[model samples]
Target: MALTTGQHSWWRPLAGTALVLMATAVMTVMLASGTEIAGELANRPLDSEGTATWGDIGDTALALLSIAFAIPAVLLAAHCVQHRPMGTVSSVESRLRWRWLAICLALALPLVLFTVAVQALMPAPAGKSGDLAWAGTPAFLTGLATVWLLVPFQAAAEEYAFRGWLLQAVGAWCRSPWMAITPQALLFATAHGWGTVWGFTDLVVFGVVTGWLTIRTGGLEAAIALHILNNLVSMSIATAFAGAFASDDTAADMDWAAVAIDVPMVLLYATAVLWVTRRRERANGTDVPGGPNTSPPPPTPQTAAASRPTGYMDPAAEA
Candidate 1:
């Protein structure tokens, strides 16, 4: 179980590079197929507006697929190669509890309310010209359901890989909690890319908050819950504003001010969730049973020395 020296610095970056390359290959294949399909099905040449819509949908699909398959597959392969046990991948069983669910909801509510309040304060963005004649259509519902199922899975997979497996691996290797956490947060943010200044900023802050939760709780479950909640909230808001904002350009119409206000609320909720869970752990005597509140005592010099081998030599023989 001992971490090898230099493993911390090298293992994560190498794994991440492999994952990214695999995802790139998968996306390339998907895109080439899509291109062939589009060429064959060109019933009518898409206008500039249609092209924008196509791009948005294509990008979303590709991103979801990359996270859903590519990253998790790579991490699982790495875990197998390292001979690391499956138990170390995530701490869900330790952290998942009804009380924690209550706390997560309590934390999410204020942020949701704040987002609503801010949206109320701002004028609705200009509406897209076309009727979403597709709004209540069965096809729309089917597509939406498909997206809901697939998108959450994609998000969860990322949380498992980055916050779960990678976090634990790095923590073990570095022998420092913060060293494991900082890199995960940075990588999480960078993965979102700098598509828009506001969105990128939001993701960076979100990454820090989630990373803190992972480190504080010694698990990915809480962070995963928070991430899923955040994404669901954002998606719901986007759906509501779909008609009000240009459908093809929703990112440009994002309520950055609202997002900024909601971010603090998420942090507050995360802290409250951690505090409540920790308190419960102490009350139930689970802290001693390896819950979040438990901290192992520092290694003493004698203890360290005891772990090393000792050798005896005869003085007369040496002479």
Candidate 2:
């Protein structure tokens, strides 16, 4: 219904890209205006804030609100740039698949909890704080509350921007899903400013997985669920035990053990999600991810040439 009203087309991606960057810059500057520490920290980057106090958490959360602008940025792009309803970014159905989202959360929660438990057991690096027992304290409660209230929005904003918006934007321009997935993942990792090789690679992998899920499920629900669960627990832990988790992981340390652990975990999670979803799709006669399995019509030479579309023709089409 919405697509019927606008001058939307693949050509709008360029406009959408510009709008997203502008929105991000404007929001960050606005949000950073009142904070004294924003400039200082922007100048002196942290290995990842060692200041694990309530004030620190609140400030960090506030800074994160800048990234949160990406959600609205996407919407503005959808309406103003793409000239389509913003809901198109969510899926072909133009709505969130909440039922699928709930199932994804159920599947993802156990793995996230397991990852946290395993991470807690890893040896702390030198200069890392180990005094994490902040429970039963006013600070802990404040930090916990802040994270619960804000992390969902923060994580959702990120998913919508990278996996939801960028993925669709790039997909509009390219036939292969990898063409869309790769750039979005790269941008996502770079945006984190992880600065370390391990951090960058880890985020890139995370982005790829989420991007793939978006295409497979034809929506952002699964990606948003996983991101919120992963970040909410992880940030809350950091908030509660600010000094407890310490690592010089901000640097370019290509920690193979950490990478090795995560690669398998990602694969395991992907396999589980697909296996379950595939079973459901088959048993219930429903669409999952890539839509139904109806075979595509065989291509004709004329149709194949036409597939490139007019005015958007490849220069090498004659070849």
**Of the candidates shown, which would achieve the greatest lDDT relative to the real structure?**
2
Candidate 1 ranges beyond 4 A from true positions: 1-63, 92-110, 113-117, 124-134, 137-140, 195-198, 240-256, 288-319
lDDT of 2 at 23: 90
Cα-based lDDT for every prediction:
0.53, 0.68
Residue 65 accuracy (lDDT) in model 1: 65
Off by over 4 Å in 2: 1-11, 34-54, 126-136, 242-254, 289-319
In candidate 1, list every pair of residues with a backbone clash.
Answer: none
Specify the highest-TM-score model's number: 2
Candidate 2 backbone clash number: 2
Model 2, range 74-185, lDDT digits (tens) per residue? Answer: 8788789866667767665566767777888888888888877776787654555555565446767777887888888888998888887777777665656667789999
TM-score of each: 0.65, 0.77
Write out the backbone clash pairs for model 2. 216-289, 217-289
lDDT of 1 by residue, 1-319 (tens): 1132122345654564466457647765776577557755864345454532333334455556656764455445445444433333444332334455455656766666666567666655455233433334443444455466666667677776667655655655444555666777677766665545665666666666776676555455566676666655555444432242234442223446655765776677777767776677677555311444445465475553222111101112223
